[model samples]
Target: MDAREAYSIKVISEIRLERLGLLYGETRIKDNDYVTTVYLKDKPILEGKISLPKFIGDDLYYVKSEGSSALMRQSLYGEPQKVVELGKVLKYEPHGKGLLILGEDPLTKAEKDAPLVTSKRKYRFDGRGLLRTRTSLYLFDNKLRKVIEGDFDVTDFSTNGKRIVVSTSQPDDDVGLNALYELNLDNGEMKRITEKEGSIVALTMNENGEVAMLGHDRGKLPWAIREVILPEEGKRFVCGNTCGSTVLTDIFDGAKERLIFRGDEILTLGQIGGEVNIYRISDGKTEKLTHGQHVVRLFDYDGESLVYSLTRPDKPSLLVRKDEIYDPNPNFKGAIPEKVASSIEGWGIITGDNPTILFIHGGPHTAYGYSFFIEFQFFAQNGFNVIFANPSGSQGYGEDFARRCVGDWGGRDMQELLQFVQDVKKQYNLTKKIGVTGGSYGGFMTNWIVTQTDVFSAAISERSISNLVSMCGTSDIGFWFNAIESGIEDPWTVESMDKLMKMSPIYHVGKVKTPTMLIHGEEDYRCPIEQAEQFYVALRSRGVEAKLVRYQGDGHEHARKGRPENMIHRLSVKLEWFNAHLK
Candidate 1:
């Protein structure tokens, strides 16, 4: 790596991730002298983006990012050009404005004269939030009818908007933990809409009016979204989880009034599979949108084109756009590549012209999405078409699929995944020198893949689990979840820990020949640092070409939230490793 490449996270090294504290990201390709960054400033810390010339200097500073509130400008150090306080507006506002997400020790009498600096809270997710156990909500609108709040959670609407429903929850065990309640926008009466004991996963309302869908916490399979009964006449599909992949497109009415739009192997937000099928409420005629198998997730459907994301083995999420459907396959214009199916069997293909891929997504439950992935795209942008699959253990599918990896961690699931990779490579005719990498469970798989086979030329394992015996105790989640996932209560008992060791990659390190890179955080409690350390130690001891990167102060999500320097360093090392091996 070039020495000129210097970058830092906006937060101080000793600082931990705060709920509302500003986080900054920057990348300077030193050899190219191009500095690209994203940041959010203090107080107004929402999100910011940076663009610098190929050349660098003191004048070469400042990053601009548009947030939910306003666009912000700040120095690389996160010093803002102006100070403007927002009203702290929130939707589905939780914890109330009164809840102290971040705190500071009471200022001493002498310290009162000094500026009062506060500490940031640890949990803050603007999109979908972490669901604890299920709780009830009382939806009561303000006297004005436009504002509504319920048992600690609230939703506010414009004064003109009619009756509204607000969703709220009480803090419980983190899972699909929130219940969606219907509120009378006028009378302020609330009724719980979700009937199942499990939490309602997501909510979607259509512009056509009177039409809505709610996806529930189904078994973690390919996700499946259920339709809700609306009034006496209209039936709508709920938009929570679609059975196939993580990225389920929004639900909508089909060409016929009674037919509901949905598809298996969905690729985009509004668009679905190769044969777009409309399910009829009256008789259930499954009409096809197309005649072939295609991958999909998010897609724009109104006037000009349809856009969406897709999932397949060897890739994660992909973008596809089409002018019209049903006539001919979309031919992406220049700058965008045509989509192709995976080489793996039993997997769908994605539409794109990106390079051949080696995608590594986190979560045995998490799949790829439209959300910004700063680190993943580095390879995609550099000519690697990304690919990955659920392989029966991903979330969004249903509980059955997700739980499949529960007690049976190293069972048929991994074997199916191995088959998936091999099938994808064989079916797609991708290079034999495949690249593999992942984080957490994915990282575990990266380690497992190398030990199981030498098919991949290069591998990257981040925040991985190398030894279950050590991790089950050291992890913060050790107190409760190990029993649930490992099928045992005792941490070190021979039977329980023995099964864990069976799934651990540390025991198989001696069999690895793939040039591997280990990336981990110093503070990751979920997988713990020992997991990475054990694997690295084992690999190095066996004389396998391997490197260990420990990001100071980082936890499980080391890559995204790791210190900026570590981010750049990890990326550089990974890219170099990939370039040397895959390229």
Candidate 2:
């Protein structure tokens, strides 16, 4: 009954030719029944809900049940945001009035909750910013007196409610890094408070609503906690990990306010790994409340217990937080992977510890979990160790760890990975016969890693960028973000190009000694196949064992998005290559 044995050569080839073009994966809603999303022309996006599941995101979230699905979109007012999704009658506050956002869903149930959000537009700043969700106002409503709404951005509040602090008209422009301000609730006056540049990672507000404490990004993570008293100098705290493992701490451990919070990174110190809680600072004595694996950064702490989401691995490719984590009818049917070791926070070998380790991941920003990364679990079922780590640049921790790769991709991130692999060896008793595989940034890392080190016995680089100069213009996002994020844009600029080439694996293909495999969809725009083709040709020309895999019309995420059978085929080929090279 082996899953790999179920696929026939003919079946896989048929899938490769037919199904490997679009997002055609089968989700097993019931036993042997497959489901996938249907984004028909002008239709509300629908996923087969035979078993009924919920989909949650940062703001735009939906919870669909047996026949009826309820959606909640954040109102322009504050947090505890609300959206309307009563059978696709998408009623949302577009500008002033509640208009139809999503017309209607074909599938309807008997009844649903249609609570109309009464808009009380308390305009302060002229809404001249982007209509993007990031700028949309989100706050926990405490001003109206009742717990009706909000959990808004806690970064821009004052200590007295009279004068609000806000940056200048060009606040966000130079705020390339740390930019926060306070707005006067009464006069609608913006006070240009702190001029730090970096992404604001976390923020917490005091009971008075006067003091909006912020957690600014520190290039190195676990973040060092700092409380910026609005329009004044920030107060730095020595919080975070001293070592590798996570230790629970109280919330108000740093300040005089006894807001018992458990944080690994107190925003100023090192990463003291553990979930952070700040339910009640309790006369300055810290008490750790809330039981969940990941720490819910205080979105906003009211006068009562700290209100935040609870995150844990309970489903496929889905990290559940808040109430959704405790959904009665959860998504996944099998067990998700738990932390294997303290030091290695998000990286570990699958417990079943399958031998053919097919370590697959993307992002260099995306973290792997028991959530909906089905391919990892499938690899585990197919007898692979399946090691994944949230390395330096992955999200979910905070701004610090996420920014560690800025201007330094192969330096610290690579070292952490080497340590991660060593940790895997110790934790999972893994051998050096490791198979390194990934896509996009991950694939870039795979290609980059093979060129620099012989740590992995075999490498599979899928849809990766091998040349930095070429990638600058070729990639869909190459013009700006890819460089700014990587701390390397304008590849043509002598200095920037030097930085790009320094990190690019294509520059030093002579160093690669491992047998590697290159897989790509011909139409991939993110990391084109030309990079893979060049690497393969070099490896083959250099008398090293290498193979190139190309799929027609498949883009960057096609291997996962393509048809079910093609997906199964990609799985088969990846595993087969690892079996031939790693096993």
Candidate 1 per-residue C-alpha lDDT over 489-537 given as tens digits, one digit per residue, 9 for 90 to 100: 6666778777777777887777999989998887776777788888888
How good is model 2 by TM-score?
A: 0.53
Index of the highest-TM-score prediction: 1
- Expressed as tens digits, the lDDT of each residue in 482-559 for candidate 2 is 567657536568888887877788888999999988888877766767889888998899988998888775676555
Error of 2 at 496 (Å): 3.7
- Judge candidate 1 at residue 75 and give its lDDT: 43
How many angstroms is residue 520 displaced in model 1 relative to the true structure, after the best TM-score fit? 3.5
